[model samples]
Target: MTNDHAETPPSGLRIPAEPVPLSEVARFDHETDVLVVGFGCAGAAAAREAAAAGADVLVLERFSGPGGSTAQSGGEVYLGGGTRVQKACGFDDTPEDMYAYLHAALGPHVDEEKLRLYCEGGVEHFEWFRACGVPFQESLYGEPGWMAPTKDGLMWLGENAWPYDTLARPVPRGHRPPVEGFAGGLLMERLAAAATAAGARAHTDTRASALVVDASGRVAGVVARRFGEEVHYRARKGVVLTTGGFVDDEEMVSHHAPLLSGHGKVSDGGDDGSGIRMACALGAATRRMASVEAALIVMPEAACRGMLVNALGQRFINEDVYPGLFSHAALHQPAPWWVILDEEGFAAYSARNPTAMPPDHVAETLAELEEELGIPAGALETTVTTYNRHAALGEDALFHKNPKWLRELKAPFAAIDPRVLARLAENRREATGISGFTLGGLHTTVDGEVLHVTGRPIPGLYAAGRASAGIHGDGYVSGTSIGDGTFFGRRAGRAAAG
Candidate 1:
């Protein structure tokens, strides 16, 4: 994905404040109205909006190209309200409906009153992304996936839209692949292009090490270090920190977000809460540091990508479910053993993708199983016979595989079988990614004012994205994190421009 490059904060938590003249500095990187750290979705949104609002902007990125979490993400933004696509899909979606669902999902701390801006701003952001040249695949008529150019088209919200139901936030809320098939990343890419064309300056490999607070306690520009030396790039107006979560820093994450160690964390090794640390130095109030979702753990036995088997050696979820979700769910298994189901599971996998599995492999799965997969002939026959005899009769009675969805051992068999499938215990584990919903950030007003723990606003200190917490409350809705990145990034940019 080609995006206008944005500079990144220095790697790790090393924001050293060293003194060097502008000339002695390796590069003549000057200041601007805003300095945006991190180039992910949130940082991109904040920098672009600030520059477009007439601010001289300098965006920093640690990576070569733009697209932070967005680049690593599935690219689904969740706004619970009436969307143009939803109108076209003939499904009822409204801000109020989304609001109700969000409120229920997040409980009282969601800060909906302050969060109203997200709802009001979502339509504009969606349209804005579209105007920047994003593409949307229309669903077939009545198929929700087969809808029309009409505002009343049906939307097939993928797994990313799991929290959304048929109530207020109706169908067609998601943007189709912006490019040929790149999801939300396309929108971010477009914005990066727009930002670059607008003359927004950025540097990659240059890191923002420290928040330069003057002796008067007024927040000054940051001291950027590139190569081996320290180069100071000063921001006159303000500094906005958009660095993402610490998903890869095993020690840091284990300390802050223990539950997430196993999940497929989008935050690369670079997204260590550096922004959070810098903002906290300014006395920012962080919140909710233990929020976690299980990574769809993958079962090990299933060798190839096409044929996936669960504990019962059967396909648990729709094989078509985004592999992000699949991988996340699979690795969370209680035990190491996995089960590969018979012809029925293979058919489901095939339906999800015909090319996903080989035809010869799909047919005559039993004999092919022992051949392709080393299963003892005697045990294989015995296991299949037993499953066929009891599985359909509501008597897996052996494992008591939820009687609700048991099936007899049909024709094509699984390549591998689980020796033992243990149910996952819900108790807390030795490790977790329970870091709360992007808190420990500079608490800000809806206007995007960075505040101290004392509730006083810091001059020239602004924040957007996860770096600015509490706007999302203690719990976040499914699609809201990216949505917040877009919504509030713009909010901070607009405010900083003023």
Candidate 2:
């Protein structure tokens, strides 16, 4: 199946190599103490912070409006470790625990210094967000799934799943802002306003074409295409690139992260890998470009209680892990995956999962389902028989699914693709069924200064959010992106201002 969205664009919009040297640049059309590209949460937060630090900041946004993929997100900020909200809700959390969990979740992608700074400053960052006008209620959601349908402040996105559950004292860290729907839009609204109020001027419909490097090898400004004109915007102090990742650029995705080729991209249009390419032109080093965060969300309650099987009809993962984690596993396994449930399970899930379409296959017995699915004569039957026996005993010895969700499958049987389950659940933004974005980008230090191949900082350049990599590795806990953006974005802005 050809994906039209991945078609190539004109050469002008194509990713660039080394930017034009500043000496070759004719004149500056605009100037600021600090220049920021991409007005998403990271850019907005960086602009606001730089402005507060007494730098004359200007932001360039590719979109006509403010929100980027952030607006299309669930708006859960992965925050914990004794935040005011956690304390107010009577849950005890510590930075040590949060650090431990993140250390495990991030795997080889972990930045020790950055993780230490983020965890140690987690509480203070939460306070800073509160001051920025983002609101959180002191409520908790006990159910296992994606973001709470309501405006509850706390829910479990993936923290309770193994091995994170055993890694730290598992607590609800996904803090959803108080918005009726799609809280990321609200977060962007408030933060964008905060940036403007902080005296940061934003130019909409502005796309950065290349970095402007001076003769001494410092990034002094940017060459941008705005309103169909090429203009030079000079930054006296520094330039911060927060233009997000390359998930939407099919060519880049295939080149860097081929595993994500078949999945749907979950980004706004601005994430085209141009930022990373432009930075790389100046010798910026990047890491983990192949790491993609695929999401598995909004599984029906019955689907939650059901089991997933690959082509061989064998259960491969615990049913209760974060949907994204499940999706990652599923993608690695053979395709044509199915989530099998019984009539009882469907009945339990139907009301909660109102968006779910009818099952792809429904049959009076397991044999009939296997025949319809074209599986070998008794493979599914044998798998289901073993699963039921173990579920009846409340013990999943093979995969260790939580006993509370374990149940025997009795006829009539129903089977649906796990991919369909992700698409049907329409409670969140960006992606519903299994959708994802790239998690890798230009490498940077803890202070958000972009690094070179020699492990040295490129003077006067910094990056944050998806623009900089090394936060998440193979798996992602929800809210980490927003949390990372706001947290490290501040550091980048401040570093640039200095």
Candidate 3:
């Protein structure tokens, strides 16, 4: 797969950042046609696909068990483009519509080739998951929330939200597998079983330490530590890295993603930048390293009834936007945002969020509350006046909040501190703390070939999942990570076997 015009690294080929080297006279302890490192959604999908394609595949996992970060997720897979669930839910969607929505959502970092390929193959990928025994019910989740609390298969995770609503007709495409309790863990469980059933072997407690390059400067295998022994696993076809992102690595986060420093972390353990660092040592270029996804959800559905205001008490974002999107905007604003709510709104919020701190200030009038919060003299009053006027008319002229949540604000106003709301809220489903994960890593082609710093594919090396960056830009919609991981993982597996 070498391009004649591709730039080759200078002599003294730097090995991966691990302590060991490819020239350490390593002996092959295990051998396979395709070797996969890190058995999350990406690794599992790669292993299963490679094995299905008649390749001998071996998977190495760091943890002593299954389920990386994917298991802890909400198990929402972003699939549309006329997916079975979307069509079953009576929604008409086309690849063009999906592509348009993503193009607008991802902004400047959107990869055209990747988006095209993903949209075109979206339905096939969804079917692939079904073929692997991942069960997706045919029901549609009626609410416009993040994830389905039941076995419902389809949900509008990103419909009627900013940018997307204007680009194409909104459609519901978030597909969740029918796994009771935590859907993510069930997803990993089924995928892991499918990988093994497809004749792929998995070695847990094995941590890949370095990449093995041959005399031709081509990736030949992996060096991993297993049972206190340095073992070299030779891969005749290729090695695919799916070791997730660097959210757990504080040093790397500070260096590459400092903006995410203060936000809460919702990561599965062992997401510590090792995968990205390893690829970097071999001269893999990184993209969007500063891009991060921070969910700043403060309350449950009750939050939709209120308005989000900055320290200046000026309404900023449409509170009805997907909580994840709202959270992303929340991170950039000046601190000390207050969710302005009236008595009925407060009652609805408090019914579920009883622990939310007592209002920073409560007054019989919005003007008095504005002064108590130290916002400019008439800023809060004017904002409320305009908001309530439009709300009473069932319209949100400024932010276009969904009419369902719009209501006129009355006396006895209370400004709730978001930090306190985040703390007191019950859980991620009810109230999500400001949390984020890294979305940037080794740059790769849509097919998952790891690219050199000079825009050429590194021979015999591939990456997927959080180990590779291409799907989303700085902004994120729910379910994209898991979908990207599995779809690209299959692509990497097929490409490696070729």
In order, the Cα lDDT scores of the candidates are 0.55, 0.81, 0.79
Task: Note the residue pairs that clash in candidate 3.
Answer: 296-327
lDDT of 3 by residue, 329-372 (tens): 87778766778888888887677555545556689987788788
Look at candidate 3 and tell me the lDDT of residue 342.
87
TM-score for each model: 0.69, 0.93, 0.90
Off by over 4 Å in 2: 1-17, 297-300, 419-433
Which one wins on TM-score? 2
Ranking by lDDT: 2, 3, 1
In terms of lDDT, the poorest run of 10 residues in model 2 is 1-10
Candidate with better lDDT, 1 vs 2: 2
lDDT of 2: 0.81
Residue 284, candidate 1: Cα error in Å is: 1.5
Model 1 regions lying over 4 Å from their true place: 1-29, 104-109, 140-172, 178-185, 262-264, 297-342, 355-442, 470-479
lDDT (10s digit) by residue, model 1, range 100-170: 55554444467666567666665677776666555544442222111122332223433222333333343
